[model samples]
Target: MLQQRFFSATSSASKYYKITLRRSPIGLSKDHRASAQTLGLFKLHQTSYQPANASTAGTILKLKELLQVENVDSIPTKEQLQANKPDRGYQVIGKKI
Candidate 1:
């Protein structure tokens, strides 16, 4: 019915728009930090992807003032993402995960 179609459309729309935080926004304006916080991005080089919707796109546009974004169609899962990066800086701090 109508509900099913709506759900299907939402599910299909969930597969695009990869948002990556290529650089840190430290020492930037408070507004930039707030935008990043709104997007759930707090660390450097932390990347997240959302559906290509108006709200998400708008958030990216706001974040662009302090971030480097690439329009990738997809992004790796959190686990896959953690596996690729080395623990160089953390090793000195005696942290390994």
Candidate 2:
């Protein structure tokens, strides 16, 4: 019973895809660019997480030539992404009181 429960728990965990835009969309068709935009990739080297499913798979396949994809065990939340970013070297020095 314990073994069965463990297997089920692992199986129920969701899988994610890490997609990074590696190429520019210049000269590409409007539809292809739109598809990439729909996938939340707006800039070069930007990464987005999406579930491993048919629709997402189709989108990735459509833009495969312009993107790099990897299977990730989990997705990072927005806060996590922000936290992972490096701090800017300069801070705002003045503000209206």
Candidate 3:
């Protein structure tokens, strides 16, 4: 039972492909633009995550020159990402009653 639990825990770890657009697709061939849109990346520096699979790999290869790809084991949550942002400086004065 212990061995089975360990195996399941290890298998539950997911693998995702973190794909980021590194360059503009403007003025490129129509096919390239279509491929980028199809992959859910339309603007420079935008990121999309997809499962690590053969079909996604093929699509990525089609527009590899304009993208940055990395294999990540986990995806960060929206709140987690927001928490990492730099805080804005504040200018405020308050009077206590």
- lDDT at position 80, candidate 2: 88
How many clashes does each candidate structure show, in the order listed?
A: 0, 0, 0
Worst 10 residues of 3 by lDDT: 5-14
TM-score between candidate 3 and the true structure = 0.73
Ranking by lDDT: 2, 3, 1
Model 3, which residues run further than 4 Å from truth?
1-14, 90-97
Predict model 1's lDDT versus the native. 0.69
Query: What would the per-residue lDDT of candidate 3 be over residues 1-97, giving only the tens digit for each residue?
Result: 9978765646545599899999999989899899999889988999999898778899899989899999888899999899999878976688678
Best-performing candidate as measured by TM-score: 3
Report the C-alpha displacement of residue 58, candidate 2, in angstroms.
0.7
lDDT of 1 at 2: 91
**What C-alpha lDDT does candidate 3 achieve relative to the native structure?**
0.88
TM-score of each: 0.51, 0.67, 0.73
